[model samples]
Target: MFHFRRSTAVACLALAPLVAQAQINVDSISQDALVSTPESVDCTLTDGSTATCLEITVKYVPENLEVGPFCPAMIDDIGGIWDWDGDEAGLYRIDAAFLTMLDEMGYHFYDEDGTVHVFDIRVEGPTDDNECISGSFDEAVEMTMLIPTTPVMADAPVSLGTVAKVGVSLSGVPVFADAPSALDTGHMPALDVCAGHVDPGGWYHYHGTATDLDTVYDHAGVEGSCANAIQDAKVQFGYAFDGFAIMGSLEHDGSVPRDLDECGGHVDGDTYHYHASEEFPNLPTCLVGLQAEDNYSTNAAGGIGAEGKGPGGQGGRPDFAAMAEALGVDEQLLARTLEEAGGPQADLAAVAAVLGVDEDALRAALPQRP
Candidate 1:
């Protein structure tokens, strides 16, 4: 149970600009051509046995091609070959020319297998054709370029309903949203959208994605992180990634952005895209930040729309079971506390504090103990 304060969230969003937020391209090639002399050649093994080999030649474009984010992963996906040995079927290196094509198309390398590998490539102008097979003479070949793989598929965009919990934090308190399986969107796909601009108290906030969350919090100033603390609050409950339902049934309705400056005191730029879910139920193309729904209100102790109940035994408070499940604690402990409360007022605030909820809301949940 991490105690999340507004300061923590604000600190994290300030570091967003420093992060690498670029998109990659692959599947594009720019090269002159491939030419081999004599077309084929004969090779002899250590035992003195000879075999026919093809002489593959290629000319690259741009002289230097950039490999996108998927290249390494794709190679690893099918299995990478370090040595220039096409001996095994389906193991072949794309000549430097082909790499240019992939780079042009935005292909990047990734290593999904959790194993790190290194690849290098050296580019040189075409010289004597004899030099092509020279490296094979002693089994020591000269090559250019070594490419490594990046972490691949660690996080995939999954529907909210399939995850055990939506990974998010609010006011620094991490709550699990685990109702995806039970809630049906009714043909409207829902996506959880957070305002990259303001906090629950209507303060300017930033940082919208998990990647940005880690960067901003760890690197930004404490004050900045505090402002964004509410951003972490979640509508879903649970640690399992599959707890919340994704609004997959959402439709893209083009609409102008609605300013939220009145609520959070910030002017977030407009946006236009597809969306579902109560948060950002309407896709505003002009104002991206305004499209977000204010899900952080649920955690306030005495707030009007707060979700979970407090430790006190009373009317609007959550049952011992629901509170236990939401907080990831044992139900018996809360149940016992409720019994020992003696009265609602004495026990309510204490219960909410322990449960990480607001005190006012906790008191509201408890029934008057006449």
Candidate 2:
């Protein structure tokens, strides 16, 4: 529900230097590396609408390894711990609360039982010992999403509600939704300065496109700054679940286009594509194109997407005690706070104010009650 906007002047200022110094790597990416053949599938939108979509499955690892030096230093700065137990076994860990929020939002992670867990810190790292804390490298995941062959706009702009995953980055990292689920309103996640962090599942994904490609380029032994690493001509970073291309902010001519819609989309020739912006919601804010069916649920055959039931299953309320423990708060205090604010019908901000914390923090801390 947060309306985000950025100063055009500031965006122009930040991009000008990068545009001049950075060059997108032309040989690094190819169509075959990122996308698969489009298949006709039935999909459902967030609004409970259904459509016949072109499902496109993509590799979890990007073709371009040069865009990621994703280092431990960056992770440490963001409060993430690698080799969490001090053993070199390569298990990563994050705040229990962060993991819990992901579950509440209906995103599932591989639990130790090989089923699913709501809050645990055992993240598996990439098999190849790369500098970046890339997850599931040995058995790379193939994710599939539905997109309409013909683009269509919704009657009203669909809100990107507590989005779990947005799209995949060109480097093959998963792109998370804009707002930080672990924090309250107006607060942001402690992401690596490069705009990415390691998930509890050990997946190294992005929340935006503010990464410094130079570090990645240097680590991969490729030449160029992060800015110039992506080809300036095409600037295709990745693809949305909706099957449209996700491009950088600048056009082929080195200028930000002015004709983009709310979802950062515009019809380029006959093709619909999205542009990454220099704002809070750096990527496209919503799916302007048609969406595919819910693939996050266990019922979905692939079960590789983020649009399904979480560990405890959808609609079943979470336990307050477990929720309180995950948020690092006292159960009694949380209950009292909720009661004073009107029990199950309390306003989140009101409860947070009474408890002297950010609304988002309080929200993330609370269980998903009916």
Best-fitting candidate, scored by TM-score: 2
Give residue 10's lDDT in candidate 1 (0 to 100): 18
lDDT (10s digit) by residue, model 1, range 1-370: 2111111111111111222211111111112122122133443322243433222222211123221121232332322111111122111232333223333443322224422222210111113111110000111111111000110111112222111112222122122221111011101011112212211111111123321222223332211222222222222111111111111112223232243221111122221112122221111111111111221223322212223434222236556576566655578655544432211222355455556666675444444433
Model 1 stretches with alpha carbons more than 4 Å out: 1-209, 218-349, 352-370
The C-alpha TM-scores of every prediction are: 0.16, 0.48
**Global Cα lDDT for candidate 2:** 0.44
Cα lDDT tens digits, model 2, 322-363, are: 867766677766654453232333457755664566778767
Clash totals for all candidate models: 102, 17
